[model samples]
Target: MTATISGWSAIVSPRYLGATVTLCLGVALLAFNGFLVSTALPTAVAELGGVALLSWATTVFLVFAIMGGAGAALLKERLGARMALIAAASVFLLGSLIAAIAGSMPELLVGRALQGLGEGIVAAICYALIPELFPSSLVPKVFGAESVVWALAAFGGPVLSGGLTETLSWRAAFAVNLPIGAIFIALVLLIVPRGIRSKAEGRLPIVRLLLIGAAIMAVSVGGLLDSPVLTGLCLALAAATLWSVIVRDRTAATPLFPTHAFRLDDVVGAGLWVILLMPLAQAGSAVFLVYALQNIFAFGPTLAGMVGAVMAITWSIVAILVAGVSDATRPRLIRIGPMLLVAGLGLLAVALAMGQLPLVILSQVLIGASYGASWAYTSQTIMEAARPGERDRASALLPTIQSAGYGIGAAVAGLIANSAGIAAASTPEALTGVLVMTFALCAGLSLPAVWAALAMTRR
Candidate 1:
C-alpha cells in the first residue's frame, strides 16, 4: 500500500521536514551545478582559449561522477550518511574553488573532474538515503520533490549563469557553488543523524568498477574525437567492456547487481533498461535541440535556456501529480510513458523540420511530462524490486545507469549529428535537415524503451 500522506502537506509535516530540506538542497546543488556549468562553458572557453577541448569540460565530470556513484554505498557504509555527505560537499567545494580560479583549460578540467566526483557521490547517497530517512509512502513524494528541485535548477541555473557570465565573469558561476556546498554541509551536520551503515559490507567490486569506468570514458572520449574510425573503435571497446562486466558478475560470489537485474522478464531488469534508454533518448534530443535553437534559430543563451526549461517544468508538475496515483495505475502509466516520448519526439522532428519555435517548445513540454510520470514509478519500482540486502546497490544503480546512459547517448548522438553534416552545414536549411534527422533518430531509439517498459508487465 502507498503511504497515507496526501498532497504536498506530507512533505512539510514536522516528522519529515528536516529530511525533506536536506534532500532537496543536496539534490538541487548537483542539478544547479550541472546547468550552471553548461551555461558558463562557452564563456569559460572563450576566456581560457580551449575551444577544441570544450566537450572535455563536460565529459570529465560525468565519467568520474559515474565512478563515485559506483562506490557510494561503500562510502556510506564506512563513513555514515552525515560524514559521507560532508565528504562529498567538501570535495565539491574544493572543485568549485579550483574552477573559480583556473587560468587554463587543463586546470578547469581538473576542477570539473572533482566536481563530478563529489556530485556523483552526493547523487548516489541522496538516492540511497531516501529509504532510510523517509517512510515508504513518502519515498515517491521525495523523488517527486527531486524532480521539482531539478526543475528549479533548469529554470534558474542558466539565467543565473548567463547573468554572471555576461555581467561579472564566467568564474563567478563556479564561485557560487562554494556557498551552496557550505549550506548543504551545515544542513547535514544539523539535521541528519550519524552511524547509519549498509546491510551488505561486501568488498568493492574493483574489476567490475574498472570495466564500467573504462566503458564510460571510452564512449565519452569517442564523442570528443570526430574521427569516424576512432569513434567506432571507442564504441566497440565500450560495448565489449560492458559485456565483460555482465558476464563476470554472473559467476561472482557477490554480484554487483541482483540476478534479475540482467533478465528482461523481471521488473528490475526492465526498470533498468527503461532507466538506461530514457536518458539516452532525452540527452540525445537535448543536445540536438540546443544546437539547433542557438545556431539555426539565432536564439540567445537565456532564451534557449527558457526553451529548455519547458521539459523540467512539465516533468516536475507531473511527478507531483503522479505521486497521488494508485499502485495499480502505475504499471499502465509505465507502459504508456515511452509511447508518449516517441510521440513527443515525432512532434520535435516536425518542429525542427518546419523550424517552428512554438511547436519545439510544446514538444519539450510533452516529453518532460511523459518522463516525469514514468520516472516517479520507475524509481520506486527499482527500490521495491531489490532483495532485502541489495537495496543500497539497487539505489546506487539508478544514477549510475542514468549517467552511463547520458554519456553513451550523447556520444552516439554526436556521431549521428556529425554523420548528418551538422558540423559542416553551410546554411540554415542544411542545419534544419540535420536536426530533423537527429530528432527522428532519437525518436526511433525510444522504440526499444517502449518494449522495455512493456516487458515489466510480463509474468
Candidate 2:
C-alpha cells in the first residue's frame, strides 16, 4: 500500500518512524549546528584571539559547504548511502572534537571546514533518501517534518547553545555535536542498506571547484586587507575568476552550471541572481546580528542569540504558511520578498542609529519573513522557467549558488567593517556605525535582486 500523508500520525507510526527520525535527524544536525555555532562563535573568538577574523567563521564554513553539497551525489555513488552516511557522520564527529579542543582561531576554522563538509553531505544525502524511503504521497510529509525541525532549531537553538556556552564554555557548545553525530551513524547502520552504491557518470569538476574556492578565498582575504585600493583589486580578481569559471563550464562535458546559468535575459539566469543576492544580502546580518545586539543592547549571550534568531524563526513560520499558495500569488511574492528585505535592512540601519530596540526587532522579523514568503515560490519559478535541457542542472545549482552568495557576502561585510575601522572602535556607537554600513549594503543589493525576481517571474 502507498504511504499516505493524511496526518502526522502516519509519519509517527512505527513502520515509518525510524526512517522518518533518521531523515529529520540529518536536517536537524545541520540546522542546529549552524545556529549553535552562530550563537557561540563570538565567545569562541574572544577566547581564541581572532577578533579581526570573525567573519571568516561564516565564510569558511559556507565555502566548504557549497563544495560538499556539489559533490554529494558522486560521493554517494562511490560509497553507497549507508557508508556515505556513516562517513559523513564520522567526519562531523571528528570536526566537533577538533573544534571542542581547539586553542586558536585557525584551529577552530579548520574544524568548522570539516564540519561543513560533513554536514553538507549529510543533508544532501538525506534529501536523496527521502524519495527512496517514502512513497510519493508522503514526500510532502517528510519535507514538512524538516520545516518543523528548522523552525525548532531557529527558535531554540541559539538559546540552548548560549546557555551551554555560559554554563560551561564555548568548547562545550561544540561538544554537543559529538553524541548527535554518533547517533546519526548508528541510525544509518540500522536503517540504510549496504548495497546502495552505484557507478556514477562524470569525474568531479576539480578545476571548477578550485576556481570557486580561490574566488572565495580572494574575497575573504580582500576583506581582511587594510588598504581600500588593494581590497578593490582583490574584488576585481575574484569577479574575473568567477566569470571565467562560468564561461569555461558552459562547454564542459560535465558542466557545473547550465549554459544560461547567470544570463540576465534568461529566466534561470535572473532567478539564479536572486538566489545569490538574497543570501548575500542577508549574510552581514547572519555574521553580525548577535554581535551587534551584544554591543549596542548590552544583551547577554542568551538574549543576544534569541534576538538574532528572530529573523530565522519568523522566516520558518512564514514559509510554512505560504507553502501552498496559488501560482497567481507566487509571482507577487517574488517581488514582495526582496522589497521586504530592502525595508528590513533600511529599518535596521535606522534603528541602530536611533538605538531603538522595537524597530530592530521589527527589522529582523521583516527580513526573516521575507524569505519565508518568497523563497519557495521563487525557487519553483526558477525551476519551471528553465529550458527543458537545462532545467535539472539549474535546479541543482540553486542551493550551491545560495551558499556561495553567503560566503561572498560575509567577505564583503567583513571587508566593509574592517575598512570602516571596526577593529579600532572602542564604543557601541562606533560599532553600530560600522554595522550600519553592512545593512545599507544589503538594502542596496535589493534593487538588482528585485529586478531579477521580476524578470524571472515574467518567464
Candidate 1 regions with alpha-carbon error over 4 angstroms: 1-4, 195-203, 253-255
The true-structure Cα RMSD of candidate 2 reads 4.0
TM match of model 2 to true structure = 0.82
Cα TM-score per model: 0.94, 0.82
Ten-residue stretch with the least lDDT total in model 2: 1-10
The CA lDDT of each predicted structure is 0.85, 0.79
Q: How good is model 1 by TM-score?
A: 0.94
* Best model per TM-score: 1
Judge candidate 1 against the unseen true structure and give its global Cα lDDT, from 0 to 1. Answer: 0.85
By lDDT, who's the top model here?
Answer: 1
